[model samples]
Target: MPRLPPVDRLDLDDLVHRYAVLVDQRAFTAVGELFTPDAELVLPDPPTSLRPTVEVRGRDAVIGALGRLTGFAATFHAVVGRVADADPGDPDRATGRVACEAHHVSVDEDGRARDLTWYLHYDDAYARIDDRWLIARRALSVDVIATGPVRKVRADG
Candidate 1:
């Protein structure tokens, strides 16, 4: 049990916010800088094109796995909410739930960008180490997704 630094509270918030922004923007390499050496990322139903239920361990593997998403040129949008719990023993260790709705878009043969939406929830574990806060693990629960003829455009409009 390590005493949390006074400034760590702010770091925790920034860490969560960064996750939302970086992931959506596909900043895979840059995102790596936010994590500790031994980080883990668990993605459930990561887009159809990617392997669903992927578990990435270690900083490099996590970053590499996320990097794969860029291949499709699709967006991995995340909407996070509420710091459910944080380990008081270690300000670097916390648990959170994030609500997310993801959408992927690409040009159809006709060259019109077709969009699809997915709804899911994220259960996260976070840890602070070396004066940096990082995601320890993330468990994703998929609620529903729109596919085939039911896909809708992203709200970015």
Candidate 2:
């Protein structure tokens, strides 16, 4: 067996951490900045519960989409598994996949609690810009989701 290169290990680890931080913190702006200019995020074929194929072009769109996702007020992301897979020919660019569990916290009018369950898979591309790794493309695949909390909703009078 041969030992992996140290630079490869560190970059891979940093890439993983960057992804974790953005998703965990609902930092879409940061997420959009993790890829290359021509990066493409492909959402694998799946069911309706999961989002269909969405191609987000350019950093602004990525940032916009993220804003909409985070506009709800509160969201939590928990990513599982290693995220360094799609190495883009060059060390400066790469692709990867990550499994994530998301907890959404929303407060409706009158301060009512609204919660939802989101199971997701993120396919991403990363590029090195200005000596920093950034996300270029990101596509989301949702496996299972519930619109309401575990408890049944009570009808309002």
Candidate 3:
């Protein structure tokens, strides 16, 4: 098995970071470009909830789901940490875990401003497609979630 090159590792890191930037910019459609055509996104059900998990396949479906973010006034996704490695026997295949925090500001159904933050970790499987690394599968695990009214506090105190 050949060792993974440093350049490939950096490219993987860049791909993870780029997702945050694209999502923050509300470029939902463009997000699909970072994934393979048959990619899948698996999202766990919220803690203590009876809701079913989110499982979506195909690039178009992924883009459509992200487009739902229009409900939020603003959103920011940051990749706080990541660890990835190429498969020892298959250089084109890799696996990784990414820790991220996503903040969303939106107006509730009643019109009040609400702030929601989700701390999550993504377990990812990547594949080198057409000379570029793209996500083939991703499973998101939620660590913590917080919600509250959007408040303004003076910093001059």
Per-model TM values vs. the true structure: 0.73, 0.68, 0.86
lDDT of 1: 0.67
lDDT of each: 0.67, 0.62, 0.83
Clashing pairs in 2: 33-135, 34-134, 34-135, 34-136, 35-134, 35-135, 35-136, 36-136, 86-95, 88-94
Q: Which one wins on TM-score? A: 3
Instruction: List model 2 lDDT by residue over 1-157, tens digit each.
Output: 1232466546756776676678556777676666566556545344443674666677666666556655455566676664465453566666666787776666677657666767887766656677766667667788887666423223320
**Model 2 clash tally?**
10
- Per-residue lDDT tens digits for candidate 1, residues 40-106, read 7777654562323777778788778777666443665766454556576655577777777776666
Candidate number achieving the greatest lDDT relative to the actual structure: 3
Return the candidate ranking by lDDT, descending.
3, 1, 2
In candidate 3, the residue pairs with backbone N, CA or C atoms under 3 Å apart (3 or more residues apart, or in different chains) clash, namely: none
Task: Work out how many backbone clashes candidate 3 has.
Answer: 0
Q: Which should have the higher TM-score, number 1 or number 3?
A: 3
Number of the candidate with higher TM-score, 2 or 3 = 3
Sequence-dependent TM-score of model 3: 0.86
